[model samples]
Target: MTPHPPTWIRVSECFLSLQGEGPAAGTPAHFVRLQGCDVGCHWCDSKYTWGKSGGREISIDDALDEVRSLGEAPMLVITGGEPLQHEGVYALLARSLGRWSRVEVETSGVEPPRMSHAHLFWNVSPKLPSVTPRWADTWAHARAWAQAPNATFKLVVGSERDRDDAVRLIAEHEVPAARVMLMPEGLTDDVVRAHAPIVVEACKRHGYRMSPRLHIWLWGPKRGV
Candidate 1:
């Protein structure tokens, strides 16, 4: 018998554009921005996603239809308030989109997906103190796929304290330094310029990789960008 893949997930926005963050930066891609998050980052740009009412809920099929409408982008980025917190959405998205595209999920690492297939790239952007321990709680599940090249762990830093905290978290998890990325707190260009150089220097000093916010540079904190 053929195995059944997960169902598609409901989402907020589905569009095509250049990936603006993580290792996939500059890559033209399709984005599936799922709504609703509880990670609680004071500086979160997508706070609107925390409320279910903020985005209209669509069926998994409709979401796929929207993606299909965009034609070919080769890559798909599934991001959310906290993607892992909503299992069915991304899993269905991953299974359905995997048929024709290279898929990636940008998560807070606060929850585990019920299903995570090999074809889907897992981008774990673990939140800091501004968020909750739930972010750290997802590490065990993510570590299960730690060996997969498609999986990358990222940390967003706002201050020197955040940098120190990220270092300790990476070490505690025994996650490979190479697999970890240090991203600046990029709410605005001024925010990026204010702290990006410091974070970049810190990345160099710590020998960790850095991830810049491509979306911010391309478009300020606007939606569907």
Candidate 2:
């Protein structure tokens, strides 16, 4: 007998948007934003997704159906309030693997990724000391993800100090410089513009890539992109 898929998953919002950050930037994609996150980053842009309760419940079928309806977008990004917080996410990713050319999971690196698949790409964003209190867990999770061939380390940089911290973390974890991305922490166009040069310089110095927040530049932190 075929096992049943999850009847419902706690979802904040799902939409079609361009890949806003990391190496896949500017690519058209489907986004599944899940609810609930315990990794409290003070500067989090998606704070609306921080709580589990406020989200609307979406059945697995409906969620998949929505992705299918997006017509032939090549990428699907399952982001969060820390997506790994939900068990249903694994099943969702498993179901999405073959359908999308790339299945990327954007995570906080506070929780270890429990599901593994050949096509899975992990965009592991490790919080710096300026934001999250749980450094040990975040570092450990980041290290694990770094070992995966398809995983990319996207460290959020708010200042020179944060850039230094990101450098140390990448070195400590032995993550490849090519797979490391330094993204400026900002919610608006001006903020991103102000920080972009600093982040760009840091990336050049450290041999890491720079990831800009494209959606924020295009839509100014608006919900639903």
Candidate 3:
């Protein structure tokens, strides 16, 4: 008898929602939030997902069933505490690619993704110096993704210092300015508004595009949006 392919994936949560950040913002998508990350960004909105034990394991078939249940989402977004941290994500991404027209993976840029399907869009968000105990591994992953045809660099800018770090990273990795998105770092609409001008100025100064946190603006910082 042939052995069965692994059916399980470590997942934090799954829901259907609009793509909140990046160039794909406003596009309706199915979100598969995987569990665990060590990047430990100070302003991470998904703090609940930081621990592997905090998430439940579900069969890959069941996860795909949930995606199909979403009706006709334009894409499948595999996000996380950091999706690349899970080895099973490769299988999940591969399976999703067969069904969805587009598959987007949002990662912290700490580890290189194992799967590199043509349809996979890598949204690499590398943490700035403020994130603490920075990982040296982020550079290799960032460099690889920078060269990827379907990848974009979405840097979260909280201060002028963060903006400087972003510029350095973009230049070092040779990421295209057009493919780079500078997002204001905030969870609330008020905070976002306060930081918007600074981020917009940074974008203009550096020739990068500005990405707004649409989900937070529409629904605050609540879950399952």
Candidate 4:
């Protein structure tokens, strides 16, 4: 018999944190943040995780063991820089789906999903023009990700143009209103509070859901929750 090489991945950090945004907000979740991102959104809070150099490598089995020791969080979130960027994450999801009551993958939708549509809660946020000018590429992904049975869309609103574009795309792509969420973009509590009105007004006018950066309100802008 031959031995198989241990599957390893670049991990920025793993922690037990409250899901800060999306339909599962406030849920106690185990978070596995992978390193490296091609999306390159300028306003991304986790900039320390922007490239391959940011995180350390660990075997997949060790990561699972660490999460097992972190107490019983009901949910597991495989997020990133971009989780889908690492092929080993598919293995992570396969092992974790049985452990957590719920599992989510928070993604920017820059790359196509490779998870074989295994049951997952995908918090799919297609970056708006304010963050990056990748219109055609991202929307193409949005259209596909929106079709997942448990997917939800969250767009970050920095200005009216961003809000308007969100509405335009949702309509063009025909994503359900209740499944679409809008969050105000900011690094500070006050800034998030200030920008929230714009997001609220957009939600009111268009009937989209609203997501508060709950972690920011509770703990301010810091890494590792």
Global lDDT scores for all candidate models: 0.75, 0.84, 0.84, 0.84
Q: Tens-digit lDDT track for model 4 on 1-225?
A: 866533898899888889999999999989888898877788888888888887999988788778768877888898888787786877788878877878899888777665644547888888877787665566777667777778889899988888888888889988889889999999889999888999999899989999989998988878887
lDDT of 1: 0.75
Estimate, for each residue in 1-225, the C-alpha lDDT of model 3 and write its tens digit. 976656688888889999999988999999999889888888889899999888889988798898678778978999988888886877787778878888999987787655677778988888777765664456667777776778888988888888888888789878889889999999899998888888898888989999989999999888877
> How many residue pairs clash in model 1?
1
Give the CA lDDT, 0 to 100, for residue 162 in model 2.
86
TM-scores for all candidates: the values are 0.86, 0.93, 0.93, 0.93
Comparing 1 with 3 on lDDT, the higher-scoring candidate is 3
After superposition, which runs of candidate 4 have C-alpha atoms over 4 Å from their true positions? 1-6, 116-119
Which clashing pairs does model 3 show? 7-60
Clashing pairs in 4: none
User: Which residue pairs collide, candidate 2?
Assistant: none
Candidate 2 lDDT, 30-72, residue by residue in tens: 9989999988889888899988897888887688788668666
What is the Å distance of residue 59 in model 1 from its true position?
2.1
Candidate 3: which stretches are off by over 4 Å? 1-5
